[model samples]
Structures are given as C-alpha cells and as structure tokens.
Target: MSSRLINEYLREDKLPHIWCPGCSHGITMRAIVKAIDNLNIEKNNICIVSGIGCSSRAPGYMDFNTLHTTHGRALAFATGIKMANPKLKVIVITGDGDCAAIGGNHLIHAARRNIDITTIVFNNNIYGMTGGQYSPTTPQGERGTTAPFGNIDKNFNLCNLVKAAGATYTGRSTAYHVNMITKLVEEGIKNKGFSFIETLSICPTYYGRKNKKGNVVDMMNYLKNNSINVKAAEKLSDEQLKDKIIVGELYKTQEPEYTEEYKKIIESFQKER
Candidate 1:
C-alpha cells in the first residue's frame, strides 16, 4: 500500500524527503495522502498549498496542483485558489510556525469566512526548518533555540482557536495515532466549510534534543501515553485530564461556505441585470 501510494500520489523523483530521521512529519504527510486516496478524489481536482517550513515541503512531493508560497502566506494563496475554482479540493499543508505564528491572521480570517478548504497543521511544537525557534504552539516552559531559558508565552490551543474562529470542522491528532490523523483529514475534506486538522508532529532533532524529550522512541512513547481521546476524556476528571493531549474530532457543524455564497451574489446580480 505504501509503495502504491508513493507511485500514485508522491513524486518519486523526490524519494528522499528532507525531514530528519524519526521526524513525524513523514507520518503526517502519508496520512494525508491516504485520506485523499480513501476519498478517491481525482488527482486533477486537488490543489495542495504550502508555505516555507519543513512541513510545507509536502506539496512539492505530492502529485497534484501544488503551490509553494512564501512563509506564512500559504493560506492567502490557498484562499485565492479556492475562490477562483470552488470545484477544486484545496488543502493547505503548514507547520506550527508557518500556520500559527506568521500566518495567524490568515488562519483566523479564513476560518471566519468559512471557506471550503482543508488545513492540516503539522505542529511539531517548535520551528524545525528555520532553526529550533519556539513556535506559537510551543508548550509554555519548553526549551527552544529562541527560548534557551525556557519559553514563557502561553501556547495557543490551535483546535480551540479555529473552532472559536468559525471553522465548521476541527480535529487534533498526533503522529503516534497515524490512523486518527488520516480519519480526521478525511472528514475535514468532506466538510463543506473551513476545516482544520492539527497533527502533533515530533521534531526529535531540535525540539527533542533541546528539551531533553529523549530519543524518537521516547517521544513516540510520550504521545502514546499522554494523549487521551476526546470521548474518553469526557469520563475522566479534570485532574485526570491535566497536561493530557486531547486527540479526536473537536468540532463539526454546517455553515455557508465562502465561495458558494459569493457565487450566489454573482447569480443574484446577473438576474437583476
């Protein structure tokens, strides 16, 4: 299945991905492809967009209409692509820093508009591509090259942020739970409005070494032990949930999608004319 997916969806020439050994970005990326395949969406009907970051490299390797845009601007570019052709399934592959830090505004506005786009955030906690800088999602008190003394800012709960901002569908999953990532992404793609799926990727090279998160195995173990499915969490006490990663579909609802609404206005004007 992996080989078939590689040949069908991935650019074989880019066989060697640049992510460090044990990095979870690869797992997250493959899950995305699996979701697309599960949907059986035509290769020509998909448009994958990305910004500058380790995770953004996915679009280049994916066999689709891909756009490699500037840092933090993938969503802006994706918005245009989605507006121009609502028939196309637009997917934005972005990292924590690329999506939540520099591209924060775009994230919120896109969600607010309820655009028909599936945004998958490969949140590895720290900036992996542009050095080991602390990202917006970096847990408070975690160490990074930019926060050698320990990060002081409160990390953003990205799932909560997007849900609050009006994303019709939202989910959170980790690289350890590869199947869940694929499931959430598949559901996100099926949604008619903005959809956000945050995949907690592991940056073992920088984030791990700097924060003393142990080796890749240890990091994977952490995800396995610390994550609680949202359904299971409902039965756990607040104390039991402390410091636990909530994983699963967080929110879902129906709303008027942006491009469709715009089309309705254009039709109304044409009728009046």
Candidate 2:
C-alpha cells in the first residue's frame, strides 16, 4: 500500500503506474518521494525534469510542475530552468541509457559547473523502455537483445565518473535499500552544489530474463548480497572489489554554485557599465 506521504506526492488519477510487474522503478520513485517528504520541501517550488525512457515517464504521475524532454536532453533543459530562477529546486529523473549513454556529456558538464541540481539516475543496467538492449551500465557478460551471446562492453561506474567530473555530492543505493536510498537523496538535495545519485534498479522484464537472473525476488537479493559499504571497501583491493557494489556516499565537496556565480558575474558587469 502506498503511504500517506507517497500518496500526497502522486497523481491519484495516474494510479497503477505503467511500469511492469516486478520492476523496481516504482520503488525507486517512492524513494524519491520519501526523501522529499523527509526534507519537507514545498512541492510547488520543485521542478522535476526527465529524459525519454521508462524512467522518464515518471513525471506524468507526479503532481508537481515537470518537463518530459527529448532523449538525453533532460539535463540541458534543467540547466536552463535553474539559471533562469535559481530559487527553484531542479530535480532530474533519468534512466541508465538516457543519462549514462546519450546524456553523458551534459551530465559531466553540469557536475563540472557545480550547478545546483539534484540528478537521480535509475541505473537498471539495460535499456528497459526501448528494448532489452545493452546500455553503458550493463554488467559485462550480461545478455541483452543486442547482445544475444552475452554482452562484451565494459560498464560505467557512474558515481566514480561523476565524482571525478566534480559533482559536490555523489552517492549510490538500490531499490531494495529503500531507507538508505531515501536518506542519501535527502542529503543530496540539501547539498549546495551539483549532486548526483545512482540508484541501482531492476528491470526484471528485460535485464533479468535476458541474463538468466531468476525472478524479481532473486534479483533484489542479488543487490543485497553483492553490495559492500564504502567504509569497508577501504580495506579491499581492486581485484577483491571487482564485482562488489559500493554503497553510501562516495564523494562530496563545497564549491561555488553555477547560478550564484553567474549572478555575481552579472552584478560586476553592471557595476562596470
């Protein structure tokens, strides 16, 4: 049953969301709502932006003002909104293929600029909305429609990549770890500069069957069994950590936010004029 808090955030007319049974995207969506509730953020002041994909469909069910943009361009549109009105909190909801593949360039540059946007990437490891095709985050050797013989491409460690690109806050959590996901998301939103979170989600319809990963329950358990807390990961060697997922905050640092910096620049120019 959806909690009172969750129901308050959703559009009741859009009840029974479109995601397939056993898909974790819905759970991830709830986590986002839970976090926002914990922070007591005014829904009207928040703008949710999404790119094209199954993950992108989320905005339609949300009651807040939202933008369902073109493939891989959610971040670009979000950037514009943030710059135009820095007081509005811009939250980006995107999928693995939408963010890591097509939108990767925008993702990195946004972090580098330290824009005040909270980006939540639903990393299901495959292209769930489009077909069961391999995506930038698909685990090596996992089967996809495009890789019927098992995938050979290397996967991206998105948190690490974004941290390197200069996101002020970076974290990871799974749909199975609902409370943890909620906490991290709240922390990310409170952060002053760009914040990027990667939520490892399940696409049981596509990723699971194609990879011979039993059922939804089994897949959810896989996340619990394979994950290691970042504190404990410090003692493990690279080889020892190869297949283990690292949970918790990976990086955070203070920086001048993009919009604030732009405001300063404009004021200085006006003074000179």
Q: List model 2 lDDT by residue over 212-259, tens digit each.
A: 888999999999999999999999999999899999998988998999
Which stretches in model 1 have alpha-carbon errors above 4 Å?
none
Model 2 score (lDDT): 0.92
lDDT of 2 at 235: 96
lDDT for model 1 comes to 0.95
* Every candidate's lDDT: 0.95, 0.92
Can you tell me which runs of candidate 2 are displaced by over 4 Å?
none
Error of 2 at 128 (Å): 0.7
Q: List CA RMSD, all candidates.
A: 1.1, 1.2
Model 2, residue pairs in steric clash: none
Per-residue lDDT, model 2, residue 249, is: 90
Candidate 1 structure quality by residue, lDDT tens digits, 1-273 = 359988899998887898899998989999999999999999999999999999999998899999999999999999999998999999999999999999999999999999999999999998898889999989999999989999999999999999999999999999999999999999999999999999999999999999999999999999999999999999999998989999999999999999999999999999998
Candidate 1's TM-score: 0.98
